[model samples]
Target: MDNIAGTKSSLVWAVNIAVVVLVLLWTIPTFGLLVSSFRDRDQIATTGWWSSLFPHEASLRFRIGDAETQRQEGEVFVIDGSVFEAGGTVSAFGTSNRDPAAHEPGEVVDFGDGISGTVNEDGSYRVTSPVAFEGRSPRLFVTSVTPPRFTLENYDRVLFAQGLGRAFLNTMTVTIPATVIPILVAAFAAYALAWMEFPGRSLLIASVVGLLVVPLQLALIPLLQLHNAIGIGKDYLGIWLAHSAFGLPLAIYLLRNYMVGLPREIIESARVDGATDFQIFLKIILPLSFPALASFAIFQFLWTWNDLLIATVFLGNTQDQLVMTGVLRELLGSRGGDWEILAASAFVSISVPLVVFFAMQKYLVRGLLAGSVK
Candidate 1:
């Protein structure tokens, strides 16, 4: 008994460790992206998101005031300025671009011909020459330790300048109707398959099961052609139909299997009360099937919201009609190196589906488990 107890304790430790590891794996990256979305472009480029939480050393280069602004101090020409515009402690400065941090701050370096320069810790700089200054101002490179910085500018630019807000509305326009049409149609079909006696019922169910394994890519071109032929060419309506058609098979299968599991006595009792088939479905099956309906609704909502290929094929990529996913893809291509924009856009695109999933998670879990057991 002692040995068995030891083995159980070891198993529990292993399971706890595995759960912690899995949670970290998912949480770390998502947390980093969220942090990154709020950071400025320079901070994001210069340091990792993990470093954004702390003060870090950074460097920048700036030019001294132009010769036009130089003042004469007796025999010496003088130029005065600050390395940092908003003020920062300067750790180092350099005259040459090739080695900007070659000299430590507050150290003077002679540029020959009676020309010398020095930068203080407060980023104030002085350049002195025996003769008048000429041409453009000489450049200086300064390194400093910057405090942790955060901003909402990335979100502002993406939502306003990049038109992500419009794309979000467009995605909603496609997703809502696509999700609803399939559920309504599938519920009716599922009820018939589950409770009504019909010819080829088994064959129809088997066909739907087979369709679940079929690749959606195979249908894209053919469906596009068919839609065009039917005069629906490349519109929200066309994409809605395409999503409905693609989503229907799985929706019907899940809802029908779930409906099949409902207690037969309830359905039979209602039938004995002279209730019509439609009334039985409306009153009895619909309420009991909430879990299943919610499960399918979440599935369809996520699928339609995240879909790219179907939207691309059936809907044109105009600014007025492009979905959030399409806008994100465009950002990936156009702003390939802009991590702040990309991360902010990605977080925005996924926010709605996350909310929907969490809101209906209980029903979704119940539907899936109940359907499987029954």
Candidate 2:
């Protein structure tokens, strides 16, 4: 009964649960990054994004009004102001540096000789003394619970102030050309390999398949030397060419596999209708091959967008020419302690890839699975 041809398996629920867990494992961190990106630097430093929704308790030190601001209120000299004007509830406070939360909110602390101070729950504080104050204001330590805070300042600081905006544009410039050029070149080559007969077609296909296993690292130095020899060194053009060259083999292989699986009858019918090979490829093959194209586009886009090594080797890491990844690396080294900025920058970096993946994911399986069975 369990093995019945049309019946569902008991493990279907297990598979679903596994998939849900995997989705959560991936999604939760990305969601946290998004939440952290919007949070204040101080909040991100002290607490995790999960605790961002509720009030947060922190011990903070602030200085009361200076003696210059003290005035006579009948017989007593008083200094009145707020410890936290930005809005928070002070649950506990103290006048001494040693014991910050010595008394509950609204309870008075006596220093000496009629000098007294009290802090209210709303962060206001009043200090009174029989004699006038003379010098610096006393320091007040407080335990406060503040509402969750979110801000765009992290994004603002990274994007505009830290040069990520320029790097973003530079990355787009590198990635778009890199992705598109290879796909165009590989589509033509793949068409030739799949549909058009040639003397060395078998060897060519075999070579492409063989190239897939070759590590990009092996070719980096040779390719860089070649580029320098050809006078295309350390520029956008060089990186674009490098990415396109590195990506071409896989693109050709994938597109060839998909194009080979296309119906023979359609090609024959087009030929019978007196359509030339070029016309058939343009009019019939491209439309039919959209899934494969989209799949390769997603791959190439993701690789080029996230790439650091190729960009570094091909495009010199000048401040003006650095890609997003390079700029991010700089930030990591320079602002390693600034969690909020890193969170925002990381989210910014992954956002485009996420959009590209979700937009084209429906075709990914179709493209990769093309010709696998038939």
Per residue, candidate 1 scores C-alpha lDDT tens digits across 65-94 of: 899889998888999988776556787778
Candidate 2 local Cα displacement, residue 96, angstroms: 6.6
* lDDT, model 1, position 346: 92
True-structure RMSD, every candidate: 3.8, 3.4
Candidate 2, residues 259-371, lDDT tens digits: the string is 99899999999999999998998899889988899888888899999998898888877767898888888889999989898988987888899887788887766655652
Clash pairs of candidate 1?
A: none
Tell me how many residue pairs clash in candidate 2.
0
Where model 2 places Cα greater than 4 Å from the true spot, the runs are 1-24, 61-63, 94-104, 107-112, 134-141, 368-374
Tell me how many clashing residue pairs each candidate has: 0, 0
lDDT of 2: 0.87
What's model 1's TM-score? 0.83
C-alpha lDDT of all candidate models, in order: 0.88, 0.87
Give the true-structure RMSD of model 1: 3.8
